[model samples]
Target: MPGARSGGSGGDGSNSGSYSGDASGAVTVWEVVSLLGKLLGTVVALKVVLYLLRVCLAMAWKSGGASHSELIHNLRKNGIIKTDKVFEVMLATDRSHYAKCNPYMDSPQSIESLVFNSFS
Candidate 1:
Protein backbone atom coordinates (compact mmCIF):
# COMPACT_ATOMS: atom_id res chain seq x y z
CA MET A 1 0.00 0.00 0.00
CA PRO A 2 2.94 2.35 0.61
CA GLY A 3 4.39 2.16 -2.90
CA ALA A 4 1.09 1.45 -4.64
CA ARG A 5 -0.83 4.01 -6.63
CA SER A 6 -4.42 3.22 -7.49
CA GLY A 7 -5.27 3.30 -11.21
CA GLY A 8 -2.55 2.45 -13.75
CA SER A 9 -1.73 -1.09 -12.61
CA GLY A 10 -1.90 -4.05 -14.99
CA GLY A 11 -5.20 -5.33 -16.43
CA ASP A 12 -5.46 -7.73 -13.52
CA GLY A 13 -4.87 -4.85 -11.09
CA SER A 14 -1.43 -6.12 -10.01
CA ASN A 15 1.23 -3.49 -9.40
CA SER A 16 3.89 -3.01 -12.07
CA GLY A 17 7.53 -3.80 -11.29
CA SER A 18 9.28 -1.32 -9.00
CA TYR A 19 12.92 -0.57 -8.24
CA SER A 20 14.15 -0.63 -4.62
CA GLY A 21 17.32 0.65 -2.96
CA ASP A 22 18.20 -2.84 -1.69
CA ALA A 23 17.86 -4.39 -5.17
CA SER A 24 20.13 -1.73 -6.73
CA GLY A 25 22.69 -2.23 -3.98
CA ALA A 26 22.64 -5.99 -4.57
CA VAL A 27 23.23 -5.52 -8.31
CA THR A 28 26.12 -3.14 -7.67
CA VAL A 29 27.72 -5.57 -5.23
CA TRP A 30 27.49 -8.42 -7.71
CA GLU A 31 29.00 -6.27 -10.48
CA VAL A 32 31.96 -5.34 -8.25
CA VAL A 33 32.50 -8.99 -7.26
CA SER A 34 32.43 -10.15 -10.86
CA LEU A 35 34.99 -7.50 -11.93
CA LEU A 36 37.34 -8.45 -9.12
CA GLY A 37 36.99 -12.12 -10.00
CA LYS A 38 37.94 -11.45 -13.63
CA LEU A 39 40.94 -9.34 -12.63
CA LEU A 40 42.23 -12.02 -10.25
CA GLY A 41 41.73 -14.74 -12.85
CA THR A 42 43.78 -12.80 -15.43
CA VAL A 43 46.61 -12.32 -12.93
CA VAL A 44 46.67 -16.03 -12.06
CA ALA A 45 46.73 -16.99 -15.73
CA LEU A 46 49.67 -14.67 -16.42
CA LYS A 47 51.64 -16.13 -13.52
CA VAL A 48 51.04 -19.68 -14.76
CA VAL A 49 52.27 -18.78 -18.26
CA LEU A 50 55.43 -17.20 -16.84
CA TYR A 51 56.08 -20.27 -14.70
CA LEU A 52 55.74 -22.54 -17.71
CA LEU A 53 58.17 -20.35 -19.64
CA ARG A 54 60.77 -20.62 -16.88
CA VAL A 55 60.39 -24.40 -16.79
CA CYS A 56 60.91 -24.61 -20.55
CA LEU A 57 64.04 -22.45 -20.28
CA ALA A 58 65.50 -24.69 -17.56
CA MET A 59 64.92 -27.81 -19.64
CA ALA A 60 66.56 -26.25 -22.68
CA TRP A 61 69.54 -25.12 -20.60
CA LYS A 62 70.16 -28.67 -19.39
CA SER A 63 70.02 -30.09 -22.90
CA GLY A 64 72.09 -27.28 -24.43
CA GLY A 65 75.81 -27.73 -25.15
CA ALA A 66 78.68 -26.20 -27.06
CA SER A 67 78.21 -25.78 -30.85
CA HIS A 68 77.00 -22.77 -32.75
CA SER A 69 73.72 -24.44 -33.58
CA GLU A 70 73.01 -25.66 -30.05
CA LEU A 71 73.76 -22.23 -28.65
CA ILE A 72 71.48 -20.56 -31.19
CA HIS A 73 68.83 -23.19 -30.59
CA ASN A 74 68.88 -22.56 -26.88
CA LEU A 75 68.69 -18.81 -27.40
CA ARG A 76 65.77 -19.09 -29.80
CA LYS A 77 63.91 -21.79 -27.90
CA ASN A 78 64.02 -20.01 -24.54
CA GLY A 79 62.66 -16.72 -25.99
CA ILE A 80 65.95 -14.93 -25.27
CA ILE A 81 65.85 -13.53 -28.79
CA LYS A 82 63.15 -13.07 -31.43
CA THR A 83 65.10 -12.33 -34.57
CA ASP A 84 67.09 -14.49 -37.05
CA LYS A 85 69.90 -11.93 -37.31
CA VAL A 86 71.89 -13.74 -34.65
CA PHE A 87 72.05 -16.79 -36.89
CA GLU A 88 73.23 -14.68 -39.82
CA VAL A 89 75.99 -13.10 -37.78
CA MET A 90 77.16 -16.41 -36.31
CA LEU A 91 77.22 -17.98 -39.74
CA ALA A 92 78.82 -15.08 -41.52
CA THR A 93 81.78 -14.78 -39.13
CA ASP A 94 84.43 -17.51 -38.86
CA ARG A 95 85.20 -18.52 -35.29
CA SER A 96 88.68 -19.80 -36.18
CA HIS A 97 89.86 -16.24 -36.52
CA TYR A 98 88.85 -15.45 -32.94
CA ALA A 99 89.19 -18.83 -31.20
CA LYS A 100 92.54 -20.62 -30.94
CA CYS A 101 91.13 -23.92 -29.83
CA ASN A 102 87.45 -24.89 -29.09
CA PRO A 103 86.10 -22.81 -31.92
CA TYR A 104 82.65 -24.28 -31.53
CA MET A 105 82.44 -23.72 -27.77
CA ASP A 106 79.65 -21.49 -26.45
CA SER A 107 82.00 -19.43 -24.26
CA PRO A 108 83.80 -16.38 -25.61
CA GLN A 109 87.37 -16.99 -26.86
CA SER A 110 90.23 -14.55 -26.74
CA ILE A 111 90.83 -12.58 -29.91
CA GLU A 112 93.69 -14.20 -31.82
CA SER A 113 93.39 -11.98 -34.89
CA LEU A 114 93.59 -8.53 -33.38
CA VAL A 115 95.46 -6.09 -35.60
CA PHE A 116 97.11 -3.30 -33.61
CA ASN A 117 97.85 -0.16 -35.60
CA SER A 118 100.37 2.41 -34.29
CA PHE A 119 98.89 5.85 -34.97
CA SER A 120 101.83 7.85 -33.62
Candidate 2:
Protein backbone atom coordinates (compact mmCIF):
# COMPACT_ATOMS: atom_id res chain seq x y z
CA MET A 1 0.00 0.00 0.00
CA PRO A 2 2.71 2.47 1.08
CA GLY A 3 5.84 3.22 -0.99
CA ALA A 4 7.82 0.73 1.19
CA ARG A 5 7.40 -0.95 4.56
CA SER A 6 9.39 0.40 7.53
CA GLY A 7 11.07 -3.01 8.25
CA GLY A 8 11.21 -3.86 4.49
CA SER A 9 8.51 -6.55 5.17
CA GLY A 10 10.02 -9.84 3.96
CA GLY A 11 6.85 -11.87 4.60
CA ASP A 12 4.62 -9.38 2.65
CA GLY A 13 6.08 -10.61 -0.73
CA SER A 14 6.85 -6.98 -1.58
CA ASN A 15 10.55 -7.68 -0.92
CA SER A 16 12.57 -10.82 -1.68
CA GLY A 17 13.39 -13.52 0.90
CA SER A 18 16.49 -11.54 1.93
CA TYR A 19 17.01 -7.85 2.61
CA SER A 20 19.29 -5.92 0.22
CA GLY A 21 21.77 -3.58 1.79
CA ASP A 22 25.35 -3.15 3.19
CA ALA A 23 23.33 -2.61 6.44
CA SER A 24 24.23 0.60 8.26
CA GLY A 25 28.02 0.22 7.91
CA ALA A 26 27.96 -2.77 10.31
CA VAL A 27 29.85 -4.92 7.79
CA THR A 28 32.90 -2.67 8.05
CA VAL A 29 32.61 -2.50 11.83
CA TRP A 30 32.52 -6.30 12.24
CA GLU A 31 35.39 -6.81 9.84
CA VAL A 32 37.56 -4.27 11.67
CA VAL A 33 36.84 -5.91 15.04
CA SER A 34 37.63 -9.41 13.76
CA LEU A 35 40.85 -8.27 12.08
CA LEU A 36 41.98 -6.41 15.20
CA GLY A 37 41.31 -9.47 17.36
CA LYS A 38 43.35 -11.75 15.11
CA LEU A 39 46.18 -9.26 14.75
CA LEU A 40 46.39 -8.71 18.51
CA GLY A 41 46.44 -12.43 19.26
CA THR A 42 49.15 -13.08 16.66
CA VAL A 43 51.32 -10.28 18.03
CA VAL A 44 50.98 -11.49 21.61
CA ALA A 45 51.79 -15.09 20.74
CA LEU A 46 54.81 -14.03 18.68
CA LYS A 47 56.12 -11.93 21.55
CA VAL A 48 55.88 -14.84 24.01
CA VAL A 49 57.64 -17.26 21.65
CA LEU A 50 60.36 -14.75 20.86
CA TYR A 51 60.91 -14.15 24.56
CA LEU A 52 61.39 -17.86 25.25
CA LEU A 53 63.82 -18.17 22.35
CA ARG A 54 65.75 -15.19 23.65
CA VAL A 55 66.13 -16.84 27.04
CA CYS A 56 67.37 -20.04 25.43
CA LEU A 57 69.90 -18.18 23.30
CA ALA A 58 71.04 -16.08 26.25
CA MET A 59 71.76 -19.36 27.98
CA ALA A 60 74.18 -20.09 25.12
CA TRP A 61 75.73 -16.71 24.29
CA LYS A 62 76.26 -15.10 27.70
CA SER A 63 79.90 -16.02 28.00
CA GLY A 64 80.64 -14.07 24.83
CA GLY A 65 78.80 -10.99 26.13
CA ALA A 66 79.70 -8.36 28.66
CA SER A 67 77.33 -9.51 31.42
CA HIS A 68 77.81 -13.28 31.54
CA SER A 69 76.97 -13.59 35.22
CA GLU A 70 73.80 -11.51 34.84
CA LEU A 71 72.59 -13.73 32.01
CA ILE A 72 72.91 -16.78 34.29
CA HIS A 73 70.79 -14.98 36.86
CA ASN A 74 68.10 -14.18 34.29
CA LEU A 75 67.98 -17.84 33.22
CA ARG A 76 67.58 -18.85 36.87
CA LYS A 77 64.65 -16.46 37.14
CA ASN A 78 63.02 -17.99 34.06
CA GLY A 79 63.28 -21.55 35.49
CA ILE A 80 65.72 -24.24 36.63
CA ILE A 81 68.28 -24.13 33.84
CA LYS A 82 71.56 -25.99 34.36
CA THR A 83 74.06 -23.37 35.47
CA ASP A 84 76.98 -25.78 35.35
CA LYS A 85 77.18 -25.87 31.53
CA VAL A 86 76.94 -22.09 31.28
CA PHE A 87 79.57 -21.72 33.96
CA GLU A 88 81.80 -24.02 31.95
CA VAL A 89 81.28 -21.82 28.92
CA MET A 90 82.44 -18.83 30.91
CA LEU A 91 85.40 -20.83 32.10
CA ALA A 92 86.32 -21.73 28.53
CA THR A 93 86.61 -18.10 27.45
CA ASP A 94 90.02 -16.61 26.56
CA ARG A 95 92.35 -15.11 29.17
CA SER A 96 91.95 -11.53 27.94
CA HIS A 97 88.18 -11.66 28.31
CA TYR A 98 86.75 -9.56 31.17
CA ALA A 99 83.49 -11.48 31.77
CA LYS A 100 85.21 -14.10 33.91
CA CYS A 101 84.55 -13.52 37.60
CA ASN A 102 87.91 -14.89 38.65
CA PRO A 103 90.94 -13.39 36.98
CA TYR A 104 93.16 -16.18 38.28
CA MET A 105 90.91 -19.00 36.92
CA ASP A 106 92.44 -21.19 34.23
CA SER A 107 90.86 -21.42 30.79
CA PRO A 108 89.58 -24.93 30.21
CA GLN A 109 90.33 -26.90 27.00
CA SER A 110 86.67 -26.71 26.05
CA ILE A 111 83.23 -26.43 27.58
CA GLU A 112 82.72 -30.16 26.99
CA SER A 113 85.95 -31.00 28.80
CA LEU A 114 85.17 -28.69 31.71
CA VAL A 115 81.72 -30.23 32.26
CA PHE A 116 83.09 -33.78 32.06
CA ASN A 117 86.09 -33.06 34.26
CA SER A 118 84.01 -31.26 36.87
CA PHE A 119 81.42 -34.06 37.23
CA SER A 120 84.18 -36.66 37.17
- In terms of TM-score, the best-performing candidate is 1
Off by over 4 Å in 2: 1-26, 60-120
Candidate no. 2 TM-score? 0.32
lDDT per model, in order? 0.65, 0.55
Instruction: Please count the clashing residue pairs in each candidate, in the order shown.
Output: 0, 0
Over 1-120, each residue of candidate 2 has an lDDT whose tens digit, in order, gives 778656754566575536454646355677789999999999999999999987776553333323445544444454435677865674455433432354233223234545566678
Query: Which pairs clash in the backbone of model 1?
Result: none
Model 2, global lDDT: 0.55
lDDT of 1: 0.65
